[model samples]
Target: METAARTDEEWQEILRSVRRVHFVGIGGSGMSPLAEILHSRGYRLTGSDVNPSDNVDRMTGLGIPVSMRQAADNVGDAELVVYTSAVNPQNPELEEARRRGIPLIERGKLLGLISRHYSNAVGVAGTHGKTTTTSMISQILLEAGQDPTIFIGGRLPLINANGRAGSSDTFICEACEFQDHYLSMTPAVSVILNVDADHLDYFGTLENVVASFHAFAGLASRAVIVNHDDANARRAAEGIPPERLIWYGTGAGLVWSARGCRLEDGSCGAYDLYHNGEFFTSVKLGVPGAHNISNSMAAAAAAHLCGADARQIADGLRDFRGAGRRFEFLGTFGGVTVADDYAHHPTEITATLAAAKGMG
Candidate 1:
């Protein structure tokens, strides 16, 4: 997707000129948060979703008019039309907006515009763990009294919502790499968890995926935090200078490293965190899985760079139960335990099952 090429002043002017914004496919996870952010910013918002969802109900409860059906008339008096990638090309409401000459922007582009309003826009990008890691960072910042603006892909239990309009200059969100969507935002801190060969339908090859991540990292104006243990993440950070690059993993000589790692009950992990080879703090994760140890380290690195102390990081990680669907415990039936997780990729599935096996 091609984003609008405009300066910060130009985007600000565009936002000022518009009052009423309409969203297509508003119930989507990505679309709902953007709508909520705009609504909180005092923009008159309306939306249409093909199916009723919890998100639709939430938007209606906020007094935003949402139509259950899509029609040309649904674009009534909208000054700007925002559509997600999932919207059909021939949708009536979109066609009506185009016919009426209303300015249109993709959801990612609008997010980019919103990101510019923050001094510290931390974008978490990776093939997996984006939601979980983003939630962890949000928890840390919020617990530290930073009051950061958050836009996670899943529901964060700390705020009891997927997005929050905060009073601080920090904006944290998931920077998705599909179709180069992440290139739209300018992040002060870019956290690349790990790169993997997914999204082949859009990227066509693993090398292309790595290249896209490299470009995304270059967009970070201040710092780039990456996983040193992942080979692909290392490749993505190859050209970055030492001063601007921050490495986190389980090894010596790293800016942020974990040591004395031990797992409890084969799921949860406790580790001693180190910064510049000095003991920073001891962290005990409330969330299950050894993979989450790595996720917590990445989150801790981001929170520390953003002005959080070691105590705040440890407390935040200890308080986080988990994201909405990343290894959620459903219930036990007939002496058999059941749980749910959103692990689709092979790598994610492997990690999730390993944690489950440990619990058993």
Candidate 2:
């Protein structure tokens, strides 16, 4: 029989054995947070990015040396190398690391390693709303005095950064599904906001996408929280033991559900939250859009699983103005209110535009 793969604890122990670590393309949203975590752990770190960015400046401020170029020399004297998927396979530093036989791992794998350290790791995964839901969970956890270690894809105003190194055992992160990156994580609670056809370039078919999500759900050690209204999400979570699956949606008979939804100025929403067919709390969200109501429901469920009470969930959702770039409001110019959003996918664009149109 073949030897079993190393457990997360084993991988974490192995990571602890290294001192000097090098990161290629470290300024990326995903890479920077992992770097922050490792640096907090006292690992001497060096990194290189092709372009200057706020993330790069942040790393430099933390006393982590970051090179502006990607030459092989930048990999000097590192015991281990970590690179993002965005980095080219032929990048000089990566080539040098391989040539020198330095142990190498991808950014997602590093995130997985870090997550294993937390007893309550909440991995928020889905085709949409990952960032928003993750931010909401972070807000609730923080408000509840959890002080979770959060790694969101977008900047969270609560922390004034995209990531933070918290002293608590709770770890909250946006678990991206692109290229099956989330498969590497073993979450204590895996929250699936929804499932849809996305990243077709990597996953050739919607079926394959669902399959990948199913695989990710299987990695959850405690529970899988899913969107009950989404058929694809329901399908993705089909085989999970009933006791291990928690469903949240607008519909009735869900473990977590929302009712009496009312929108303020056709944007922000207020709803009565129900848990197990009983009233949990009344949630008034700071963020706009009907979609956000669903996102909040999911966030609420995840937070509850992580020990947040009803009051914390409601207050947290109420305090979240929105993650950076998800329907962000820019200052009005010439009486035309300006706004920015990171909505590329058709589904996301539709929801964003609908929210904007509703504002009028």
Kindly give the stretch of ten consecutive residues in candidate 2 with the minimal lDDT sum: 1-10
Residue ranges of candidate 2 with Cα displaced over 4 Å = 1-13
Task: Tell me the number of clashing residue pairs for each predicted model.
Answer: 0, 0
The 10-residue segment with the lowest total lDDT in model 1: 1-10
- lDDT tens digits, residue span 1-360, model 1: 122655657656878899999999888889888998899889999999989987788899889999999999999999888998888878998889878888778898889888988889999999889999999999999988888888988888777778878888899899999888898888999999999999999999999999999999999999999999899999999899889999999989999999988788537989999999999999999888889999999999999988999999999999998888888777899997777798999999999998888787
Candidate 1's TM-score reads 0.96
Pick the lDDT winner.
1
Local accuracy by lDDT, each model: 0.90, 0.89
After TM-score superposition, the amount by which residue 103's alpha carbon in candidate 1 deviates from its true location, in angstroms, is: 1.8
lDDT of candidate 2 over 48-72, digit per residue (tens) = 9988988899999999999998899
Q: Model 2 RMSD to the real structure?
A: 2.6
Query: Which residue runs of candidate 1 sit more than 4 Å off their true CA positions?
Result: 1-12
